[model samples]
Target: MIDAAEHRVVDCDWHYQDSFTDIVEYMEEPWKTKYEKSNWDAAGVKQNLSSFFPTSTGDRQAYGKIEREHSNYPDKAETPDRVREGMEFLDVDQSIQISHLALAMGGVQTDDERTQAFAKAHIEYMLEEVLDPDDGVYGLAPLPYSDIETSLEILDRVENEPAIKGACFITAGANPPLGNRKYDPLYKRCEEIGYPVVFHTGGSGLDDYVRAGYQEMLETHTLGFLESNMSQLVSVTCQGVPEKFPDLDIVFMESGVTYVPGLISRLEEEYLKRPEEAPLLEKRPSEYITDYYFGTQPLEVSASPDLLELCFDMLGTDRLLYASDYPHWDFDSPSTITDLPFISDEERKAILAGNAVEVFDL
Candidate 1:
């Protein structure tokens, strides 16, 4: 049995690679042919996308090397050595890793072969490297949102796998809005299999945070979280997904909890004003919102201590989880959060591992 004290920390949000080549390996012959002929090279795509994030001064070259190596060894990111290193750095017992690039692959245009190739590659990588490991590392499987049948098929394949905790769908893109009935089948499958559905911010391709004509990476990264978090909330409420999948657990990743109170308040107010248009809910919108979970990181230190109390008061403590967002620039060190000011020691322990233990059934 895993000791709660020794194996207590569970990072709710960590990342893994989305190497195109790795994804392409599992593609059918036709898809592979299409991807090989595509104009956009994998390296170019990654470089262009990285420009939107804040990179360290000397890290650009190192990132280039890392990306290149990953492009070659698609499984490199999931290697045990790398996972262990990350766990040590964050002082966490286990990691629930989501892949931004892999999720993006689901949005790639399926009319062409490249899209098919991308899906096959991503699914194969998730199964072989990310989810098949016996180590403590856990994975969020990517779904091919472009094709619901395929997405459901993939879910069916991975849901029973012990290493896989849930399916990850991006907050934005060609994928249908979260509230659409089209997603009901997927949600139903998740509910049947007892796996959560996770929505991660970013990978919109067009950086919403990038100011027009302004190229500062820092500005883009900072503003990106705001846009992403708002979109996530909107997707859940405006799209009416919660009403459709009342039993399904949804996790909002990387987005902080500070905005949740205001969002839930607004949702409740709107529900009260327009009960005719929104008739599916059994309780107040805030009550439903409280049933969902939010993974926090780089927590707003100035206000989070008090905000933590506010969130528990409003959303309940079980609805909030801790995440380190490890290896990223804004990554929060585990030790730093171990003694967060204002929060009781018991609350801190719940955030660190107890909540995750219940959520993931770890």
Candidate 2:
């Protein structure tokens, strides 16, 4: 248990999700029975196809390594009481409860019905058990981009739920990028309704390019999370998703902040050369990035802290929210951020809590 020096700490991203069957128990259909009756999300019942392609759940994968070796089981570790204990230890005044297992299964399901049921059931369980406390554990609803109607319905259901703050669409496959016109409805609705979408992705739902010739979990874990977020980051900015929905605020989770400056620079370079292509873009690509926030987990540990120093100086103190990536193997905490010699006390306080309160309206 680490003391937060009495600062108002806001953990922007926290995972409190469990195994598939845990969410299945909340389902109201044949899907619930199917999960309980037959082992779903397990070996043989449903194999981890992509891991075989490179590294997956059943094999030497990033997440499986965390569970098998690190002892951080998503379902078992993430409970209201358990999370409360973590929050207490970290002195987290507010945190956003984001889903994982269900979203990871977004496109993996051979049966769409199971996917739909799992999505709804996961939301139901989070709303009741994990996110129901209303004790600063803010619910960030997971909206499956693949299931538009169900996603919309879930959004409408939680539109006014007090503790419900934002929404999320997992980014694994490039099939339906965030910039796709089909996802316009979800984005438009979130903008109108004032729900910030905390976009997250990694390991499981990856594009074909990611797994090509890939061999080890280390390779994927090190790069997979960044690759997934980078695609969405490029899509939303270049396609002018931020400009179209000016109110939308997206917090890119897990992917470190160091890459953002470079990505923005490249985007600006392309934008300047071909401004005519993205007519909807109102300002420099970097400006739109400020409209978004970022989680500080897997904190950048460079031989020279100057790189991390440079990234923060470039991005400023507004949108970099503190995140522990709690219950995961690569969790970051107060010491990680606070001990950064480059971060001034003012900026440290802002990252710790100030920025999150304003962004999430906590």
Task: Please report the candidate that would top TM-score against the real structure.
Answer: 2
Question: lDDT score, residue 317, model 2?
Answer: 64
Error of 2 at 118 (Å): 1.6
Weakest lDDT window of 10 consecutive positions for candidate 1: 51-60
Worst 10 residues of 2 by lDDT: 51-60
Best by lDDT: 2
TM-score (all chains, Cα) for each model:
0.81, 0.87
lDDT of 2 by residue, 57-124 (tens): 32332545455333345324345677787787777878887765644654463535666676677777
Task: Please give the clash total of every predicted structure, in order.
Answer: 2, 4
TM-score of the candidate numbered 2? Answer: 0.87
| Candidate 1 TM-score versus the reference | 0.81
Clashing pairs in 1: 23-121, 179-239
**Candidate 1 per-residue C-alpha lDDT over 48-67 given as tens digits, one digit per residue, 9 for 90 to 100:** 33322222112322344444
User: What residue pairs are clashing in model 2?
Assistant: 18-75, 51-55, 51-56, 172-205
